[model samples]
Target: MRIPFIFIFCLLFSAGKAQEFAISNYDVLWNSQSKNSSESMPVGGGDIGLNVWVEDGDLLFYISRSGLFDENNTLLKVGRVRLRFPQNKLKEGFKQRLNLADGACHISGAQSGLQSDVRIWVDVHKAVIHIDIDHSKATNAQLFFEHWRFEDRATKKKENNQNSWKWAPQGDVKTYADEVGFENGSLYFYHQNKKQTVFDVVVKQQGLESIKDSLFNPLDGRIFGGFLYAKGFVNAGIEEGNYINTPFKAYELKTAKPSKRQQVLIALQTGQHLSPEKLKSETQKLALNSASSAKKDFKNNQRWWASFWNKSYIQIPKTADTTAYQVARNYNLYRYMLACNAYGDYPTKFNGGLFTFDPVFTDSTATFTPDFRNWGGGTHTAQNQRLVYWPMLKAGDADLMKPQFDFYQSILGNAEWRSKFYWGHNGASFTEQIENFGLPNPAEYGWKRPESYDKGMEYNAWLEYEWDTVLEFCQMILDARDYQNFDVKPYLPLIKSSLRFFDEHYQYLAKKRGSKALTADGKLVIYPGSAAETYKMTYNASSTVAALKTVLQNFLQLPNELLNADEKAQWQGMLTRIPEISYRDIDGKTTISPATVWERINNVETPQLYPVFPWKIFGLQKPGLDTAINTYKFDPDALRFRDSKGWKQDNIWAARLGLTDEAVKYTFAKLKNSERRFPAFWGPGFDWTPDHNWGGSGMIGLQEMLLQDVDDKILLFPAWPKDIDVRFKLHAPQQTVVEAEVKNGKANIINVWPESRRKDIIIK
Candidate 1:
C-alpha cells in the first residue's frame, strides 16, 4: 500500500537558530577526483578532504591543499588553490582515474595513442582544459574549481594520437612556460584568466620545492594543476548573452605576497566579499536565504557532526584505553570525508586521491596520499573501504552521504553499458576500479603475478551485488529529495537491475523445504565469484548471502502503492528462492559458516556475521540469531582482517553482538596500545594509513552494545556493562531519534520520536 508522507518530528533547536561546533587539531585548514593507474588505488582520494574535516562546510568555491616534506626532500605542501563561481553545479561523483571530462578526467577511458579534444588553451595565468560542450543557458556550467600546484614533473609529451583523458607526470621538460607551467617544486599552473576576471588561485605549493624527491614518485605528476570544478572556467568566464550572467558585483583581490594557507583563506573571503555589516543587514531581510546558505550550512554541518557523537560515543573513563576518544574522533573524521569529497565529481577512493594530489611513499598517517607503494600499488583500498562509509547514511550525516550516492548514480549509465558489453545484459556491474573505465592497466607494476593466486584483485564481477547493497542502503538513507515522489522511485530501477542479475544466474533447487528454496547444490551458490570482501578465496562466502538478502528485502520493503502488483509478485518469488545459510559446528554448541564451504579458505573465516550485522537478514531477535551470535563468540578471531600481536576479535564481536564489557575492554586496548600514532590514527598494516574500518566499525559496534534498537524497538543499553551506568542517543532506521539512560542495569528514561514527530535529532 501507499506509504503516507509524514513529517519527522520538527525538532526546533534550543540555540534558537544556529549552533557552532568547531573541530580542533585538524586546523580546519579547509581544502578541497579520480583516475589513472597501473593498478587503481582501490578507493580514490577525494573523500579525504571532506570526510577528514578539511572544509568549512562541504562545499565552497575554493580548493584546499596540504603536504609534509622531510629536510632531505624538497616538496613541502601536498597541493594548492583554485576557484569557482557558483556552488550548486558542484555535483559530487567518484571516478576511476583523473576525470577531465564533465565526469572524471582520467587517462584510462580512451582508445588512445596520444590525445586530442581535451586540449590546453592557455593564457598568461594558467591553461584551461578545453573540453568543448553545449553551453548552458542559465549559468556557468554547473561545476568548476582551482587548486595549488606543485607538480614535480608534468610531461608535455603526447603518448597516443586519439582523444584521451589521462595526464602523465612531468617528463624531462625542465622549464616552466606561461601557457603551461611547473614552477617551484610543487607547482603546476594552467593560465586561463582571459575567459574570467582577476587572478584568484594560489602559489603555495610552488613555494615548497626545496624538499627532496626520494620519497615522492617522479611520475605522479597528477599535481595540483588548479583544482577543478570538473567544468573548467567556461570560455574564459561566463559566456556572453546569458540571462543569469548579471555579475553579482565581485571583488578582485590583489595579494602583494607569495602564499600561505591563511593568505588563501583571506583572499577567498575577500573575493566573495560579503561585508559583515551587509551580512548582518541581510540576516534581517534575507534571514531565510542566510539560514539556507552560509548560516544553515555552518549550522547543519556542525549539527551533522555533533549528532554523530551524540549517538553512542564511548570513552574509556579512567581505564587503560585512554586513547579511545581520539581514535573514535578521527574515525568519525574519515567517514565524514567519504561523505563530503564528491562535491560535483566522484567520491575520491584511490591512493592518488580525486584532486590530483601528489602520491608519495611514507610510513602512513602523514604520507599525503598514505600507503603509496610501487609494486603493490598503494593500500588505499576498495570494498571494505566502501563499508567504512555505508553506516554514515543512518548516522544521518546526509550532506556527506549525498555526494557518494550521486557518484554512484552518475556512473550508472556507464555501468549499464559495460553490463551490456561484458555480460551481454543491461545490469550495473562495476569494474574492479569503480571510477576508471575499460580494463586493467598493463602499466601497473603488479598487473601480473604468476606466483600468487591473487593477481591484483581486478575481478569486477562481484560489484553488481555490492552496488545492490548500496542502492538498498541508500533507499533507506536517501533524503526526500533523492526520491522524486518522496519515496524510493529514483533508486527502484537500480535495485531492479541488480535483482535481474540473480534471476538470470540462479536456479532453484529441485527438492525444497516448505516455502524455503535452495541453490541447485542445496547450498546458496553465488557463482562467478563470492562477495569480494573477506579477501580470502572462499566461494559462496557470507558477504554474497548478505548482498542477496538485502536485494530481496529491498523488493519486499518497496511500498506496494509505488510498485505494481505484478512487480511485487516477481520479487516475492525471488525472495523465496534464496537459501538458508550453511553452518558448521564450532566446538559443540555454536555453529558458523565454513570459511570456504566449497572453495579455498584464507584470512579470517568468521566474518560470516556479515549477514547479521551489516546485512540484517537475521540477527538477535530472529529465530537462529543467538546461535549465530554464539558461533561468533566461540572463535571471534574468525573475523580479524589485520591482526598482528595481542589480537582479540572477541571484543569487537562482543560489542557488535551486545556483549558490553568484553567488547569495551578489547576496543580500549587497541586505543591503549603503543603501536598506534600519537594523536590516535592506527596503522602499520599492509594497507595501513590509520585503518578507520577497525576504529569506525568499533564506534558502531559500541553503539549497538549499549543501545541497539533491535528491529527498530529502541532498546537502550541492551547489553551495556552493569557498572558503567551510561546513556546515549541514536538515529533510528525511520529517522526516529531515540534516547535512553541506563543506570544500575536498568535502561530507562526512554524517548522515541515517531515519523510524524521527529525531525533531525540525536537518540540520546
Candidate 2:
C-alpha cells in the first residue's frame, strides 16, 4: 500500500506531540501558606539551589551552593533571604506555579486592590539568582538576609544515636563566615574555612597522619560567598536573630522609591586558594556582568531546560485513576530536582541535596538548626549514594553525570594512598561510608573501637564488608561508554582500582587464615564479610561474589586501548579465584543464598537478589532466572521487607525478573505523591524527608519496567502494566534510543535509532 508523504509527516508530528511531557498551566500549584521550607518549591541551575516558599505572607528562600563545606564538614547554606511587601496585597488570590518547561517559578496574587507577579530563576551560565517583580501600582518592599550561624559556638554534641554524632568531638566549631557587612547599598557575606579543616582532624584521628601529605583536602583554602545587589534599595542596618537576645545577624535593605517594577540580583563565587577580598571583587564583577547580559542569560536558561526536556520524556495518557497520573508526574518532578544541581562539584547529596529545610519542621523534639541532618555532612554512603546516579543512564543525563565521575577521580589519589598505607596494596580502598577526603567517615569508623580491631575495617557492623557497591557505579561508566562513546580512559583507573581492592583484600585475608582459607576446590573464601549489612561475619556472600565476577567480566570487555593486556589478564585471573554464587533449597525449590555462613542477621536487605539487579547475572533472558525468582519468592528478608522505601531493591528486582503484577504494585507505591505539597517530596522513611535514595531507587525501577537491555537485545514492557497507556523515550547501550508507545494493549515501536538495532527487540 502506498501512503502520501504529507499523511506520513502529519502522523509523525502527532506521535511526537503525544510523547511531549510538558506541564500545562496550574498543573503544579500551591495556593495556601507553606507550613515550612520543607514544603517549598525547589528552583536552581548550575551549582546553586534555593528552597523557596511563601510563609506568613512573606517570601522566604534558603540559598545553598555546591562545594560550600564548612570547617566542621557541613555543607552549609549561603544564607536565607526574606522579602516583605504590603500585608493586604498577599491576603487573597495567591498562587504559585513551577513552570517546568521554562525552569522558573511564578507566584501571583491580588492585594491592596493591585495585582502582583513575581518570577524567580537561577542563571544557567553563571552563579547568580534573578528575581523580577511587577505590580499594578507602585509599592514598597524590604529584603533581609537572615543568617542564624553567625558566631562561633562550642560543639555541644547531642546524645542522639544518629550517625551525625558518631565522631563528633567536644570543641568549638568555627563558623564558616568570616564577615557580614553592608556597604555601598549592597550586602556581602563570605565563608572561608580555617587553616585546619575536618580533613586534618579525620587524618589524625584515623592514624593516617603519616600519609597526610598525600591526602587530597577539598576544603583547604576554599572561600565562597555572594553579593546581593538591589539597585533602587538602601541598606537598613542589621538585626540580630528573630528574638531580642538571640546571637545571629540579619541584614536588611529597603526600597528607596515607589516603583511598579523591581529586579534583584545575587552573584556567587567559590574556589580554592581564593581570598575574601578577591571573592568580594569577583562577586561584584559577576553582579555587573549579570546585569549587562540579563536578557540573554534568561533566554539561554530557557533554552537549556528546553533541550533537557527534548532529550527524553515519559508521558502517561490522562487516566480516570489519578494514581497513574501522579506516578508519571512525580517521576518528572524528581528528575527536575536532580537537574537543579546539574553541575555541582560533588554529586547531588543523597541526604537533602541542597533542599533541606529547618529541622524543627520535621520533628519538634529535634529542634536543631537548619544545618542538622541524620547523616553527617561531607559523608557519602556508597550503597545509598549509587542509587542517586544509576537512573541517569536511562534518563540520558550524561552531562549531569560528570560531577559524580569527577568526584571519584578527584579523590582517587587519596583513596589509593590510604589502601597502600593501611594494607600495602596497590588498589583504592573506598569504604562504604566515605568522607569527601577519600577516607572512611570519622564517626562511622567509631571512636571506641577495640584495640585488636582491624584499622582497615569500619568499627560499625553494618558497613564492615560493604565494598562492592562501587561496582554498580563502574557499570554505569561502562554503560555510558556504550551510550555516548566518549573516552572511557579517564574512568579506567577507577574501575580497575575498585576491583583490585576486592581481589587483593581477599587475598590478604586468605593469608591471615592460612592455606586452608581456600576450599578443596581452590575458590577463595570471603569471611568476616557482611551481605549488605544483613548477614554479618559471613563467608561467600552472594552479593560480593556477583559484584566481583560481574565487574571483572565487564572490565575485561573494555577497549584494548583503555586496558593493557596485563590489566586484562589480572582481572580475568581474579574472576577465576572468585567463589561461585551460593544456592540453597527452600520447600523443594532451588534459590540463591545470601551467604554460605553468617553469625546473625543485623539488618533487613535482600542480597540474594542482588545478582538479579546491579550485577544482572540473572533475570529475563539470562542464565539462572528460575533461581533468582525462587530467591525473591522465598528469601525471608525479601518477603518481609518488600516495600518502597529507602535503599529497598524489591521493586527493581521484581521488574528485572519480569514479575509484572508485583513490579507494578511496588512501582506505584514507590512513585505515588507523598503527603507533602510537592508530589515528589517523599519520606523520612529510613532517611530524611525528600529521601533522595527512595526517589532514585523508584526511578531505576520505573525505567527498568519500561526497557531492559541485555547486550544487544531489548526487552519492552518487561514489567509494565498492559492496562496503562504510556509514551517514553529511553536510552540503551550502543547510543541507541527506544521510543515506544503502548496503547490499548498493543505495543508500537515509534522509532529505534540506527534502525538495524530494532532487529533484537523482544516485545514481552
Best by TM-score: 2
Q: Output the TM-score of candidate 1.
A: 0.57
Write the residue-wise lDDT of candidate 2 on 495-584 in tens digits: 889888877778788888786546687677788687887888888899989988887887788878788898788778778889999988
- Residue 392 error for model 2, in Å? 0.8
TM-scores for the candidates: 0.57, 0.94
Query: Candidate 2: TM-score?
Result: 0.94
Question: For candidate 2, which ten residues in a row score worst on lDDT?
Answer: 158-167
Give the true-structure RMSD of model 1. Answer: 16.8
Model 1 Cα lDDT, one tens digit per residue, 613-691: 5666555455676776766666444544434212223444565566556666665554433242222233323333344
Model 1 stretches astray by more than 4 angstroms: 1-9, 13-263, 266-344, 348-382, 431-433, 436-487, 506-525, 531-539, 635-652, 669-680, 725-727, 742-746, 755-764
